[model samples]
Target: MTFAKIELTASDNAEFSNIGDETLDGLFGSNRTMPAQGITEFYGASGSGKTQIVLHLALFFLTHSNNPRVVYVSTESFFPIKRFRELLQQKLTRDYENGSEKSADKSKTVEEYGNRLLLTHEPSVESLMNCLTVRIPKLVSECDGIKCVIVDSIAAVFRCVRKSEIPYDERSRILFKMAAALKRLSVEKGMSVIVTNQVSDIFPNDVFHVNQRLVADKKPALGLSWSHCVTTRILVSKCDPMSIPVTLPGGKQSQLALRRLHVISSPFCPNSSTFFVVDSNGISSVHENPTL
Candidate 1:
């Protein structure tokens, strides 16, 4: 795979690229979740809705636009195809119900929307590098409307290196190279690039904290070097279970679980947090906290 030199105009190099969702955009700060010519990272522990958020964004770009497409690179064991299809179907149904359209041809819509998403699996660091720096650029050149590129949990590939014989510095160097390639792609191709990261526990060495029996702090993987590559850093964590009383169809009451999304660092907005829940219809019920 190879990259083509595409010249970008001033307007194409705007400050920020809007995903066209107000609530999702507002989750970052006051402005867009990411820079127009940079990278945004979503880091969190397992079951923190990292994959869910990225899949939702990919669906949005695929369904909302006429010709734009998204390239999702997965490093995990497998991409969540069932969840993605469910989200896509729900989105189509919801749009049809909300709009004035009388007829709902979901099959055709699903085929079209689903076709726009390109999924690639990169199981190793070397393959991931080749995909990003080579294969992705080539795809962009051939596919004129490629709008976004997503790598769900970038930490997965690197974790293999840690368990292997590769030196630590090699990981950092490769990370910088990947960052440069991603930034260049974002600038030249005029596409939004987002990557998800894993979290690791950071235990305090101080005896006082140990004596106090404090819990370990979870930080994004790949340390400070990798953190510097991203323009925006968003952390999603499972906070205290929020029980929302809901009335069932037969007058029965039930509770729902919600997760917390925190904007750790961003160039546009101050650090603020919001609560959101992922259901069968995808990410919904986002309640912002004014006093962050």
Candidate 2:
């Protein structure tokens, strides 16, 4: 029997799509060539805009790429379809008011844009595993130009499964298998795998204190096993709202609070942070230059 050899080259891979946020793209690299072939983790406290960022990325892939499609697997049973539509409508209205596009054209674009996204609700670990291993692969093969797969809050399902019932070893094995499957899918398909995680509180002793108090230090959940599977990890936290006085459309002065984005870990970029505001049109950077 003759053995077949496989060839590897850069040309065989799909290029990474820009997240449509200038500051975020800049953080990845100077040239912005962060490939979309590995798992990226976004973890933070609730109300920290984790899901908003995921939605923004999904919008970017759908609108910016050539016939691109994205699969969003939401385990929380809360896919904000109405909110997404509002964001899209706001963008279209902004473009029309700016004389960037015609009303007729914008309506057509909105309809097409909505068609590109496929949202799935998986409430359990077993369903999530089926989605990642079976359904997603089948969808990718059948659909053209599928670019990204996002799992909102990967920690939620695991959290629901009681640790005492599953045991640490069993849980670790399951997570390992899931991570390995996701990694393999990303590499083989040349698509980005984005997963959001929840943060847990940790208390560490301070050098100045003889007795350690229970200070809440928030870190990503899922332990070290899940941590090793990701290519990039971004941590976002809400800082004290910055009140900036601005002139409203009616020439009235108003104050707006911009949310800050923190990058906790990235292999291609250094640890840094930036500021942005979440409006009807989704996330927009507050400053011309992001804080390093």
Candidate 3:
């Protein structure tokens, strides 16, 4: 069957996001390429800074190009005011130190930018989807330019599944609906969508541990659905069992940074999954890949 091809917008010569630095490659699409507009799901344990990464990406889009407005929706009820405050302060500071530092016309342009970066907190999948399809589109139509959107954590929507009075198959269908809907919205609006997921420690039972491959067959159906819906699915987990301490700016407050890396479960990955770590400097790829 012959199919008609739609011409892709020339990426508007949108500069490719500077993905990697010294250590982390796929830290932010470092080794891998990012789709202009599609589903990107990051599955990791608690406190992996997955939400922070998505926020950073949105902030970059807003500050770098004033035209591309970013909409961030939270499904986990994980919207923290402190994080947004920190981000706002940083962006404003950057405004003060505008290029050249010579222009006396410290006009309203910079102030407007801070406002342009929109953030919405939706507590449920139903409400989130409503905002996405009805509210966001209208905002784009009436508002000046809106470009990118980041959903803090998509998996949180599933939490309602257990609470849902609906049937099992219906719940699964609901999950797929949101995923597919988000994909369509991203494509239609020429915006990028990044989602985060919660993962369970899935390993082969001790008896079946002799051969690791045999154990992998036990992956959960939920994980399978996530794989099917998202364009890119990356699994992130701790590489080593030993906890590593990381010092923060305050000089005393520190975090037990997880020495985790990406484990590619998708069939597309050939170079094994990439090892990544986020520490004092930020997210980075580890030098050597950890062994199973």
Alpha-carbon lDDT, every model: 0.70, 0.68, 0.55
Off by over 4 Å in 2: 1-14, 32-34, 92-107, 142-145, 205-216, 241-257, 288-292
Q: Look at candidate 1 and tell me the lDDT of residue 292.
A: 19
lDDT of each residue in 119-200, candidate 1, tens digit only: 8899999999999888776777675546788998788988866545667788888899899989887777677788999987
Preferred candidate (TM-score higher): 1 or 3: 1
List model 3 lDDT by residue over 37-133, tens digit each.
4676666666756765566566556555524556778877656656655664555465567553422234545555456566778887678768766
Better of 2 and 3 by lDDT: 2
Model 1 stretches with alpha carbons more than 4 Å out:
1-8, 11-24, 30-35, 100-108, 205-216, 242-254, 286-292
Report residue 99 deviation for candidate 3 (angstroms): 8.0
Report RMSD (Å) for each prediction in the order shown: 5.3, 6.7, 7.3
Ranked candidates (lDDT, high to low): 1, 2, 3
Name every residue pair that clashes in candidate 3: 23-285, 24-284, 24-285, 69-147
Best by lDDT: 1
Clashes of each: 0, 0, 4
Candidate that beats the other on lDDT, 1 or 2, i.e. the better one? 1
Ten contiguous residues with the weakest lDDT in model 2 = 1-10
lDDT of 3: 0.55
